[model samples]
Target: MARILIVDDAKFMRVTLSNILQKGDHEIVGEAENGTQAIQLFEELSPDLVTMDITMPEMNGLDALKAIKNKAPQAKIIMCSAMGQQKMVVEAIEAGAKDFIVKPFEESRVLEAINRVLG
Candidate 1:
């Protein structure tokens, strides 16, 4: 199972993602409320994968994604975006996100993205 870090400003979103991932048998290494915390936890935990929310306070996911990728070129990051953020999603992919899941996440899609990225 992949060790995963979930980053989002909403506690509900984080918990929801955690539940879905746990059900998929992936370990939740850590959770972060914003990009800054995400970056800090990323370095500290070195999780196998990260699910990063596109819009967040403190810093945004794209910036954090870039930072993480810069530090660890092989980092596996999956961008989490709400509907209507297609532009950001494209940017995320170009920035090295392995995959992306739109908000109001479905369990199947989340697991699919994780599996594809981990593979």
Candidate 2:
């Protein structure tokens, strides 16, 4: 299992994601409510991976992803987004995100994305 950091604006979404990742034996190193916080946490904790939301206040996930990748090029990240965000997902992939997962979460998809990125 890997250490993971989860970044999302929704409290329930964060909890749901944390629960799922925890069950897989991944230790949650930290959580962030927005992208700025995520970037800060990422620098401080340097977890094995991060699950980042696409939309957030005070700095979107894509911006944070760029910031993180710029500083730590080896960092592994999975973008979390909703349907109809294909363009942003493509941008994230171009910016070095390892993979992505759609919201209104499915357990299998989430797990699959995690494993694929981490593997």
Give the per-residue lDDT of model 1 (tens digit) for 26-74.
Answer: 9999999999999999999999999999999999999999999999999
Q: What is the lDDT of every predicted structure here?
A: 0.97, 0.95
List TM-score per model, in order.
Answer: 0.99, 0.98
Q: Estimate the lDDT of model 1.
A: 0.97
lDDT of 2 by residue, 34-69 (tens): 989999999999999999999999999999999999
lDDT of 2: 0.95
Winning model by lDDT = 1
Candidate 2 lDDT trough over 10 residues, lowest sum: 110-119
